[model samples]
Target chain A: MIMKKTLKFAFQKSLPVLFGYLFLGSAFGIMLQQEGYNFVWALFCSIFIYAGSGQFLLVSLLSGGATLYVTALMTLLINSRHIFYGLSFLDKFKKMRQMYPYMIFSLTDETYSVLCSCSAIGGIDENKALFFIALFDHLYWIAGSVLGSLMGQYLPFDFAGIEFSMTALFVVIFVEQWKSFKSHIPAVVGLVSATVFLLLLGANNFILPSLIVTVTVLMLCKNKVMEKVGGET
Target chain B: MAIDYKTAIAIIAVAAVCTFATRLFPFALFSKSETIPKSVQYLGKVLPPAVIATLVIYCLKDVNLSQFPSGIAELISIALVVGVHAWKKNTLLSIGLGTACYMILIRTVFA
Candidate 1:
């Protein structure tokens, strides 16, 4: 009974992801197919890689015939932001026991955002919900890629700007988080740091530096920030 | 396109391993201790909002403000999302409407 309830709640929480992943994943699939690979390659990459941006970059690397060393380096640089995500989930996931490793492995940007905002409701198992959320997202990605690779050229509709759903999802989460917290300092720090770096270094090279600056600023003012958050919660 | 099968597989494997390595790095460093450091705990608490904000900016990084559309489509759509979400507090409705607004803007007004 608890398992069923958990699955239902997880499904509800993952609805936004279902749309975002399906669209982005299918876009990845169509791109891969146009590069001469087929659905099998799409399935393999989605299952193994699972990083939305990283996988898109992978398709390009494959076509460009990038060396293994360059592929490794590029993947690390592109996905380096993930290092910060695990910091927030360390203790929460540690309690998940058997699900710990998988939880860590599946912590994509979307999953991280959802999990960060997902609060525990009464009578529901948190760990199971987390596990299912991860599983559902992974499945949606796989299904979308396979579907797109098989029918990409035949799709009648134009998905030109459907990718904005991802941006909108982020906006929704940001608003939710904003309302939940008493302090907006962290959000401001993140905004200022990212915008500065994005202008300084182009889009392709801003994430890492921005993250470093944000972390450093937060660490430096930890006492003040904690006072506000700690008093509220 | 000119790459061989063996090379392609190697590239995929390397990318997968490297991606996993980034996700695993934080855990490997901090999980060994029975008690996480106070500083690390502090970051764990405050980083989520900051990170989410950064991600929002990251998603919009490619929109060129100097161009013809000049990010008007993104600006208008995001304003609508924030306004409607603040008013309705409905997640699905906000995202659905926001995306639809962007799609229509790009295809019709900005096309």
Candidate 2:
């Protein structure tokens, strides 16, 4: 009974992700298909690597015949923000017991944001909810990509701007976080830092540098930021 | 494609390993400790808001403000997202409406 409720709750929370991942994952699948890879490759990549940006980059890298060393380096750089995600979840996921490794491996940007904002609900086992949320999201991704690969050629709808769903997801999350948190300073710092870097370095190269600066700035402002956490909601 | 099947598989495997390694780095370093250090704990607490903010920017990184549409479509759609979300506090409605609004703008108004 409780298990069913948990599944429903997790599914409710993952609804936004369902739309976002289905579109984005299928887009990846379509891209890979255009490069002559089949659904098998899409399934393989989505199931294994599971990083959206990394997988997209992989399609290009494969087409360009990038060396394994370059592939590794590019993947690391693209996914470097994931390192910070683990930091936030280390203690919470420790209670997940045997599921710890899988939780860590499946921590994509969307999953991380959902987990961050998620709170314990009445009558639901928090661990189970978290686990199911991750699992459902993974399933959605795999299904979307595989479907897209198989049907890429037949799709007639204009998906030219469907990718905006991803942006909407992030914006929704950002607004939620902004409203829930007592201190807006951290968010402001992040926005300022990222925008500055985006302008200075341009889009393709700004992520890593922006992340580095955000972390550094947060570390330096630790005392001030911590002070505002006293009455956090 | 420039790469053969075998080489492509190898590259995918390498990418997977590298991605997992990044996610595992913090746990490998700090999981064994009896208690997480104060500094690390503080970062863990505060990084989410900051990171999410950065991600919002990351999503829009490709929007070229100097171009024809001049990012007007993105600007209006995001404002709608923020506005509708703040008023309704409904995640699904906000995202669905925001995305639909964006698609319409790009396809017609900005096309």
RMSD values for the candidates in order, in angstroms, are: 1.3, 1.6
How large an RMSD does model 1 have?
1.3
Off by over 4 Å in 2: A231-233
Per residue, candidate 1 scores C-alpha lDDT tens digits across B1-111 of 568888888999999899889999999998779988888888888999999999999999999977899889998999899999999998899999999999999989999
Writing each residue's lDDT as its tens digit, candidate 2 over B23-86 gives 9999999978988888888888888999999999999899887888978898899999999999
Question: Which 10 consecutive residues of model 1 chain B have the lowest summed lDDT?
Answer: B1-10
Return the TM-score for candidate 1, rounded to 2 decimals: 0.98
Worst 10 residues of 1 chain A by lDDT: A224-233
TM-score, model 2, chain B versus true chain B:
0.94
Query: Which candidate leads the pack in DockQ?
Result: 1
Write the residue-wise lDDT of candidate 2 on A1-233 in tens digits: 89989999999988889978987899899999999899999999999999999999999999999988899889999998888888898888898998999999999999998899898889998998999999999999999999899988688886778778778888988999898887898899999999999999998899888888988988888878878886331
Strongest candidate by lDDT: 1
Native-referenced Cα lDDT, model 1: 0.92
Cα lDDT tens digits for candidate 1, A90-202: 89999999999888889999999989989988778999999999989999999989888999979899888988988998999999889998679999999999999999999
